[model samples]
Target: MIYLTTFLFMLLAYLFGGLNGAILLCRLKGWPDPRTRGSKNPGTTNILRFHHAQAASAVLIFDLLKGTLPVYLAYFFDYSPVEIGFIGIATCLGHIYPPYFQFKGGKAVATGLGTLLPLGMDMTGLLILTWLFTVAVSGYASLAAIVTALAAPFFVEQIKPEYTTPVIMLSILIVLRHISNIHRLLTGKEKKIVNWKQ
Candidate 1:
């Protein structure tokens, strides 16, 4: 029944992750859907374009929470590292392609951050720092994501070897998802974050 249990847990994790707080908030506020706005992405960055920074921050935190809680639940259940990683990946996938959003959802950055929380604080911290550094230096979310994803395999392998395969697979998927963004970035046409204070 272990396989069955794992599948059930993954399904539940996906359901939780699919709760797109940004889209919900936009609908409640009668604001334009973020997917139809700047960048055409249903994520915090796009939300910031349509609403206050506070609103976008709220959505980001909520999305991160959705990604985090599931993996924690799997850990609580005393699952194997592979199982936990599977659940974590499932959560990211759900956030990236939420059923509630008709399978069009946010990029998996925040969700990936959430999934890494249970792996270990040090590893999670490293990933966060790397992502922040990339974003700060490049101001391109896609670049940050790609750089962070490329760093994931090394981080997981060095710190959590048991999860290496899963982490590597996740990194591949995240990198693939950002391929279009990479192309735009190369062409100097990638969407840049606007200074909202003005």
Candidate 2:
């Protein structure tokens, strides 16, 4: 029964993650599907690029909650840190490869950070600052994501060793999802930060 419950929670987490906020919100507003616009990535940045900041903020909050809910539930049920970590991973997988979206989904940046919120705010805050600093300095959101993914597991290892493996898995998954972005960066084709006024 314990195993069954755990599996069920993970499944729920994945389903929640599979709920693409950009896609859904765009649909709600009768706008173009985000997956078909801008960078063709259903994420906050893409929405902000083609749509408005208000829409982008909605997507960000929605994605963050999806990442936070499942893990928080697991923690509330007294699951171990390792179990919670796996649940977090499941949420990220859903975002990256959502079954509802025919296995095409966003890069899981907001959702991945959401999963960490239940574990410790300090780690999450550090990663957020890293992302902000990288984006501010480099003007490449994908670069910031890659750097954050690389840093996440290391931070977990130092503060919560039990969560390291799952965090590492999540990190690898995120980096892999950004492969095209990495290629763009190397080829000097990556999109830089867009001016909010323009």
Candidate 3:
């Protein structure tokens, strides 16, 4: 019965994560599909880049919640760290390759961070700080995401060893989703967060 419940929660997380907020919100607002503009990615950065901040904020909140809500509920119900980690993994995977959107989805940085909230606020905060610090110093959002994703397992190992394996899994998935960005960075083709007058 417990296994069944966990499976159901994972499925729920996946379905929730699959709902691409940028796409749905843009469609509802009669704006161009985010997938058809900017980076051609249905994510907050893409929306904010080519569209309005309000829409981008909405997408950010939605993405965070879709991953957070399910995991938080599981945590509240006393689910094991491993179980919670699996749920988080499912949530991230759904965002990365949502079947509802033809299996193409966002990079899932926000979703991945959101999943960590149920583990510990310190863990999540540290990762967020890592991301922000990287972006501020380097101005490359993709680099920040990559750094944060890579740092997740380290943080988990220190704060919650039981979640190490699951966190590592999530980190790998997040990094894999950023492979294109990684390539661009290596080739000096990746775009920074905003234009600078350097």
Q: List per-prediction Cα lDDT, in the order shown.
A: 0.85, 0.90, 0.88
Q: What residue pairs clash in candidate 3, if any at all?
A: none
Q: Write the per-residue lDDT of candidate 1 for residues 1-198, one digit (tens) a residue.
A: 999999999998888888888888889889888888788877777787777989989988988888889888888989998899899889888888899889998778778877888888889899989988887777777788899999988998899899888888788878888888988988989976632344
- Candidate 2 achieves a global lDDT of 0.90
lDDT of 3 by residue, 1-198 (tens): 999999999988888889888888988989887878867889989988887788889999999888889889988999998899999989888888898988888988889888988777899789989988998889998999899999989998999899999989989998988898999999999999855556
Using lDDT as the measure, name the better of candidate 1 and candidate 3: 3
Question: Which residue pairs in model 1 clash with each other?
Answer: none
The runs of at least 3 residues in candidate 1 whose Cα sits more than 4 Å from the true structure, single-residue gaps closed, are 194-198
Tens-place lDDT per residue, model 2, 74-106, is 989899887888899999989988999899999
User: 77, model 3: CA deviation in Å?
Assistant: 1.7
| TM-score-best of 1 and 3 | 3
